[model samples]
Target: MATILMITGDFVEDYENMVPFQALMAMGHQVDAVCPGKSAGENIATAIHDFEGDQTYTEKRGHNFTLNANFDSVEAEDYDALYIPGGRSPEYLRLNTQVIGLIQNFFAAGKPIASICHGVQLLTAAGVIEGKKVSAYPACQPEVEAAGAEFVHIEMDQAITDSNLVTAPAWPAHPAMLSQFVKLFK
Candidate 1:
């Protein structure tokens, strides 16, 4: 089983984050939700995770993970790949120098990196998506491209793959996204 280090912030897309986390477990892969901060009993607090204005809010707590580890803590050569989920979390996560360093560590080693929704922001901020084809929430197209990536747009299509990277749209595309990501480890 592949040891997948999935990171998040204070608030992230709850469902999108959980689905893959659960799927990886079901597939017998080791998954850890690394976060920037924590709440009760060393667990991270994740709310509605809304960044666009604000619709509704709810707070759910997940166990504390590796917030201190950077690219130097774990090399890309150690892990098989990385999966990034969308949410306002990306905006905050991209700001973490440690996280950005880890992102680059993976790409430089040619390890597969899967990014969904606003998660693309992390890759963009890390300067690892350049010259690659990617897709996001549409509004983020400019940012992704500006980071040196080609944005793929389509209502229904296969996941976009560029070298060791994989990109997909929103939640509706999770099935395809998860399946494609699983194959990367095998």
Candidate 2:
């Protein structure tokens, strides 16, 4: 089983954070969920982003998710893979230099990384997605392109894997995204 590091923060999408964390654990992988400036046992508020008949997704308050690891204690080399969930959180997480460095470490190590929706923002900000094909929320396409990655416009329920990276547009693509991600472990 692999030890996966999940980097998340307040306002992270509920399903994106909860489902993958639980699903990976159910598969016998050790998943450590962490947030900047927080420690194990601490909790981060989540939000539900739903697509309605609107121009974009709608947000609603979601459950509080507990952290299982301390961000400061995380050593990127200790984990076999990285999981980054999407939501409004990525918008600011990208600004954290340590967070960007952590992501770069994983990329430099050639480890597998899975990102969804806005999570691509972190990868872009880390300057590690250049020359890759990445999928993220439609609103993130421009950033992906500007970061030198080819933006993949796919179905909401689909995912794409480029080298050691697996990405999807949103949580709806969990099945495809996770399946592809797990393959990297093999």
Candidate 3:
């Protein structure tokens, strides 16, 4: 089993955070979920994003996700893989130099990374997606493309894996994304 590091923060999409956290744990993997400036036992407010036939997805308050590890304690070399969940968090997390550096370490080491939806924002900020084929939320297409990555838009439930990177548009793609990420441990 692999040790996985999942970075998330307040307003992260609920399913995107919890599903992968639990799914990876269920597979007998060790997963540490953390957020910048937060410590073990601290919680982050999550949001539920759902398609309600509106011009865009609708947001609702979701369960509080607890942090099992301290962000300041994370060392990328200690983990075999990285997971970045989508939502509004990436918009701000990407601004943290430590966060971006942490992501860069993963890429420099060639570890597998799985990012979905707006999580690509962090990847772009870290400058790790250059020339990579990625799939992200429709609204993130511009950012991904501008980062020098080829953005592949697909249905929300679909995912695309290119070598050490696996990405999806939204929570609906969790099943595929998780499978691909797990395969990286092989």
lDDT at 128 for candidate 1? 88
RMSD to the true structure for each prediction, in A, is: 4.4, 0.5, 0.6
Candidate 3's C-alpha lDDT?
Answer: 0.95
lDDT of 1 by residue, 57-143 (tens): 333544323233333345456678898987678998899888898889888887777888789999999998888988887778899
Whole-model alpha-carbon lDDT for candidate 2: 0.97
Q: State residue 183's C-alpha deviation in candidate 3, in Å.
A: 0.7
Q: How many backbone clashes are present in model 2?
A: 0
| Model 3 agreement with the true structure over 1-186: per-residue lDDT tens digits | 999999999999999999999999999999999999899999999999999999999999999999999999999999999999999999999999999999999999999999999999999999999999999999999999999999997889999999999999999999899988888885
lDDT of each: 0.73, 0.97, 0.95
Worst 10 residues of 2 by lDDT: 177-186
Candidate 1 residues lying further than 4 Å off, grouped into runs, are 39-41, 47-75, 156-158
Native-to-model Cα distance after best TM-score fit, residue 29 in candidate 1, in Å: 0.5
Clashing pairs in 1: 130-148, 131-148
Q: Report how far residue 153 has shifted in candidate 1, in Å.
A: 0.4
Clashing pairs in 2: none
The TM-score that candidate 2 achieves is 0.99
Best by lDDT: 2
